[model samples]
Target: MKKLYSILTTALFCMLFWIIFVLQDINLLKLDSQEVITGIIVSLIVAYFTHRSFIKEDPFWMLNFKRLGSLIAFIPIYAYELYKANWDVAKRALSPKLNINPGIVKIETEVESEYGLAMLANCITLTPGTITMDIVEEEGKNYMYIHWIDVAATEIKEASNTIKGAFEPWVRRIFK
Candidate 1:
């Protein structure tokens, strides 16, 4: 079952790659026959090479269909929030108020995997006015040091939630 799932996932990604290439018109030969043959050869090579790593652990967990559904579901809402953040940043820059309280705060991350930690860091960096400075693991827990443009209350949990609410759940589904 695991091997089957892994092969399927690899095939899916290969199909995705072929689609991208076709859409981009990147095939060397204009002939459909040549393109199909090339795509098949590439997919087989990629699948064989990538198959082992794909199922060594939890490939199905990352391929969670429900999580993919949720991600699609959240796109519009997340886009709106991102737009709002961008406007807020622009307004703050233009306003005389200059409401920035830049500070570095240490926050705990519940995500146990390295992939999750990387996702958390990227999430913080993606959001306006926050950047993950460092991630330190101690006694099997990740502690991230983050720089925030506005730091209200010195609570670590609050800082942690900023990344969590924005992107953690989706990342958890994808990589945890």
Candidate 2:
């Protein structure tokens, strides 16, 4: 039963990716039934290998499956935030103020999983005005060192919370 579930889940995820890729390319699926069939075949092959490779003893990947909805909701919002941040940074860079603090600060994050840490780090890097320097895992805690364009008062804490706020709840939905 578990194996069946895993196979189905993996197949479904692959199929989703295939569809997204096709739609992104905006290739006319109507005239090109071949593309659809090819995508399905590819998705199936990818799913089978992925399932075989990570099957059993590593349930966390599947556990993270529940976060799909969160991931969907986050992407658009984060994209917009990143776009806004880009403009802000561009303007700041061209301005006389140069508005950059260029400091590295330690931010404690509640997300402990490697996936969660990675997502948070990527989010920081994607957003304008910030760059993730390093992730420090000590005493069972995860801290991300980030360089910021504007290190406002309580900067580290605020940025930490911002990073967490972007994806933590959604990740919780997916993983737990």
- In terms of TM-score, the best-performing candidate is 1
Q: Mind sharing the TM-score for model 1? A: 0.75
Score residue 109 of candidate 2 by CA lDDT. 80
Q: Please report how far candidate 2 places residue 5 from its true position, in Å.
A: 3.2
Which residue pairs collide in model 2, if any?
Answer: 66-174, 67-174
lDDT of 1: 0.74
Q: What is the per-residue lDDT of model 1 for residues 1-176, given as tens digits with 9 covering 90 to 100?
A: 87777777787778777877687756545548866777777886788788886456665665577867766766775677578778878888999989888899888877777766886687677778778899998898788898888886468788777644666666665555
Deviation from native of the Cα of residue 64 in model 2, angstroms: 9.8
Give candidate 2 misplaced runs (Cα > 4 Å).
Answer: 1-4, 23-38, 52-69, 72-80, 153-159, 162-170
Q: For candidate 2, lDDT tens digit of each residue in 71-166? A: 777778777877878898899989987667666678888776676677778888878778888999889888888887777645667767754555
